[model samples]
Target: MSSKSTQTQFDKNMEFGNDTTELIRYITKGDGAGLAYQWLSTLVDGFGHRMVGSDSLEEAIDFLVKSLEEDDFDDVHTEEVPNLPNWVREDDNVEIIEPRHQRLNVLALGGCEPANITGEVVVIRDLDNSKFVNVSGKIVVTAQQFKGYPQTVKYRQSVKLFESLGAIGVLIKSVTSFSINSPHTGSGAEGARIPAASLTVEQADMIDRMFQNGEKIVIRMNMKSHSENHTTTSRNLIFQITGAFRPVNWLSHLSFSGDQQHVNLFKMKRLDEIVHLLNRNGILLGLVNNPSQGDVRFWAKDGIPSVNYIPDKAIDYYFYFHHTGGDYITIFKDGDLEYTASIFAVLGHIIANMDNWGPA
Candidate 1:
């Protein structure tokens, strides 16, 4: 971290003490809380799921630009992100056909090329590419448990190897430790295009048990999802709070879709300063020097010191509702969203006010 003042970092708190204190108050306990959640409620409820190529995403972006501009944020705008991959879920049907009958919940993953196929079941509770067989003309059913999303999603999404082995389709157990028969959807890996859908954890486990008990299992996956048109249409919504000092030194509002989001601090001494500020103000969150995902990679690749704030209440239930029908505005606790906003508000204020970029 770089600083102009000779004072030690903690004493530097004296610099932002009064300003940050009031900013925290205004955001957490003042009208800002109501206004922030109001905007969030409108976006999540009014627009619904904002997947690429869907009208909901465009509407959500439009709403953000409009709301931010109306609030008089400086240089509020939407920038076009072109040539991105686009996938949309239209309809799906997953069912056990050979022995009795059951319909399973499903969400066709992003980047899954459309197909309709029926294959014999090969339930693999643990999947490893190097050690596998009997999946050539089968629906590979997986109930790989949740270790962590970054680790577990690989089993769910990485299907190129399975594709190469002549697997027709895949049904991944929702990548979460606990579930009430809720399915979770996410982006498939880059190369695998076989039709795939996420199955509820309960469904995957049941299928695995049936296979273990010597039952001849076969399933039919009839999907009508598409990404046929080559052109991908999406927007990166942005609003800039111009720096009063050092205009070239600016931070951005990080926007991401799907699971890839991370932040790396690059050993900036000023990072410590903001951590102290959050501690003083009583905001609890998980922090890491190098996290694995998109927001961090995008900024860090361009030599920018950006912070990706993921609000964790420590119970780790985020995956339970993500990308499913259960993903709703009601998931957030009272003042939860506002507190997150306050963390960014404080960091943005400090970063915008700094005279130099840190740890460059």
Candidate 2:
């Protein structure tokens, strides 16, 4: 992948005229690198975890709207959206009490019901019904290796399967491929809400080993997590850079900064063009065939062609810090943010300036 070769290919296949070229050049050379980092710093520093329905989320939305307005962006506004059930974990503790007392690291899953239980730990190696020994009145510990998030997360996210078998509580191994003694938190599916939490891969493995060694493991769990039934309003901040030309309403390209998985190649030709453009500018980016399941899914469902781009090397950043107490501005490097901002700005400017930039 020589830069000269990429540039030659990009020039030969160019469809948009001089305006698009000029816009892309200006964006790539300009000092818009600070924009993304500034926004990220403000969000993480000013408002701590912006969970849905939390005051932090509202404050973050207000901050975004104000920042966009200050930058003189066109159509900067907020739209009210129905909020999901807000779950708050005030206090939670899980400890091994019987087989040599040791406190374990745990994070209560969102939407999990609160409970206090003391029971022998039962390890479920597989989901096979035939191998099921009666796990009645026990704390079930299960670990599933990461195949993919959607495929493997079901064992942990759905509590009904464990509850129906008379499990008092549940402890699932974190979904991440690696862990630094950190537990990840995510929402559970709509089902029998049970006292459920996530344990680091190491911790879960240790528990499983103890169960296998004919050691009786007695664990005590105290979870104060709860949720409000009443719905509240949340805001989605929108900032539009109105195009100079008449915008095409039929197609759209979306780049999400939320999740690490890339998805949905609605317009493959346009994607190829963008990839070439980025590569020509010496910005190495790749597209993967994975379901993003990010916010872009909603746009795609509404009959618009959309695509999502997650930054390279974002997987470690997301798993280690995102949605956890460690998600602070300090976790990000200045150079990385600058590169991300420049690439996004270039892509956005080119798309905004292209004539008849819509679905064929």
Candidate 3:
């Protein structure tokens, strides 16, 4: 991979030293559990729907700026930019104009031209150039079919294509489960977007059946879906953290074999020694995995393999802790019951008996 990408990737994975963890833990404990829960709850709840250019987006920005500032973040800011048009469903309705008249469900397509008059519907097998003679000045109804989004949406824009041939409106087979005469609407774009709507599958089937039976099926559609030019804007917020005695230390050489069960023994032993050592010297040894291993290279094989401890996100920290539960061996080390390695076997063998067991 390129050095820039590698560096960009590395910057995200790195975290602080033991002092950082101690500091975080101390801060959390000092604030009490209730306050912590309240902070998180407010952060998620106050944001609401953050869709660009919407009221929710503005509210979320103000909430973040205030919360981060209160949380002691030195600088918090937002970058503004124009947002895309957000179409919404306004109103819709559909009805069979002939052949056992009935109301069918329908919806308006976004960004479509308004209908001057509720037009009559005409059932057609297809809308190729050849069908223009019979479809002019009437709503064309047909079974909608497509393979994907952009492709499927062609039916929604069928009205505009038909309009070029002097057609009025387009009625599509509702692309939904169970026909309730209900129409579903969606956004569409064109030179001069035309009004479009959908009918339930059942209603579509009835219309097609009439055509197959040599009977003309007609329907009336009244849909209200329009778009207006509006200034849309959105915001992007950013924050950063700071520390004084920042240090980067590389830990290596310590190695072991066996499943996590065995690893826990080593972990307990190290934790006990480190904590006692720290307490005695008025210094702290933070037990943390090397954060640099988060690079994509760690997962990519074949190259010179990096053995730095994988970042916490790569491994299930909670699972490891739970799996090691009750397996830890504690010892009276320097007047404190610290975690130790009394339960683990050396090279998978039980050697030293009870009394012979002493600090190695």
Candidate 4:
């Protein structure tokens, strides 16, 4: 609205005021309801766990580029980000050799060194104190402990603690309390020389019980991982609707910009995880445990008001699908995708029309 352009040119494509309301209403009704959901579903189903440096992820990015271009955005492109940690999971096997022959469900943590070791597991139920038992030449096992992700993740990040004690490997209990034999994968073991992986909560609990009963819990872990620490290249997709011309105040969100000032919260996919992790350790960096862990902390650090754009409607208790094998499109309810799309589209429209956001 600020720019004076010829009416016949008619190419600004900016809308404001009641036009925003009408556009939002348009996405909710009839065919528009399912647009976002459809695109998301197609991506997930076609790509199937698109990890960095993988061919599937690259192909998926290409797919997104085409989709956004078809939608006629002002500009749609991917900025190549080099030197991303690309630790490929070659093959892993965790079997209880001493007690029985049960292969536990496991996922290798990113940046874990390639290793194949069969050692007794030293179960540490409470990681707060562990001076009693000698973990030298053994594997360390920790649990989620119902303390939410903030507290639970410390066990995963404590690879050096166990390694200093001569522990050869580490196995952390997944972030979710509820488990149906799903191993959650994450990246906290970067630059670690020893191997690390996540085991299901059920199996971790069983290990705890055995340790309590004075049983020699011996497990063999054979994991193979290839690290491409600074060699691999991936992309950050950038697309936006052109806003009305009133100085264009933009809302903040953490990105893969690698700006040390801002934490990266871009990889997190669940609103449930974000909500549950908030307000745990009092009031530090939005109160979500550590600044290195949560992505939303940097915005808070800069005094820029920000919100997690993810939805909170009918959130799952376990977030079982997130970063797990069950993350495919089969779990979504009828019109779930469409409804979420509508909400996002509406929000985008509002932002495009806004004069400015945050501080003056």
Clashes of 1: 3
Task: Give lDDT per model, in order.
Answer: 0.73, 0.69, 0.47, 0.66
Higher-ranked by lDDT: 3 or 4: 4
lDDT of 3 by residue, 1-360 (tens): 244533221124332124323433343344332443455446546664344456777887898798888978645778777656654445556677666678776656555655545565567554454255476777777665433333444665566667676667777664443333445554443345456765565777777777667875666656565444674767767664432233212111232222343454544454344333333333333444332333334332322212333322333321122111111222112311111111111101111111111233
Taking the candidates one at a time, how many backbone clashes does each contain?
3, 0, 6, 1
Instruction: Evaluate model 1: give its lDDT.
Output: 0.73
lDDT of 4 by residue, 95-198 (tens): 88877778988988877878888898888877777657688899898854767666567787888778877889899888776678898877767878788898
lDDT of 4: 0.66
lDDT per residue (tens digit) for residues 1-360 in model 1:
234543434345446655667888888887676777788788888987777777888988888888888888787777888887676678788899979799988878777777778889987766674245678888888877688777787877657767877888988888887788888888773467688888999999999899999999989988887775786868887777876555543366332223333222323456666666676677764455554444377765655454666666442577777777888888888888888887888778877766654343
Model 2 lDDT, residue 242, Cα:
67
For each candidate, give its TM-score against the true structure: 0.87, 0.83, 0.44, 0.77
* Cα lDDT, model 4, residue 334: 78
- List the candidate numbers ranked by TM-score, top first: 1, 2, 4, 3
> Over 4 Å off in model 3, which ranges?
1-78, 82-88, 124-133, 146-151, 175-184, 189-193, 229-360
lDDT value, candidate 3, whole model: 0.47
Worst window of 10 by summed lDDT in candidate 3: 339-348
Which ten contiguous residues of candidate 2 have the minimum total lDDT? 256-265
- Mind giving the per-residue lDDT tens digits that candidate 2 earns over 1-360? 465545432255444334344544554455553666777777777787777878988888888788878989877878888856766667799999987999989888877877889999988866665136688888888866666565767766656788888888888887777677888767662455568888878999999888899999999999887777786788767667765565533224553223322333334445567766666556688865444546578865554545666777765546666455555678777567766655566566556655533443
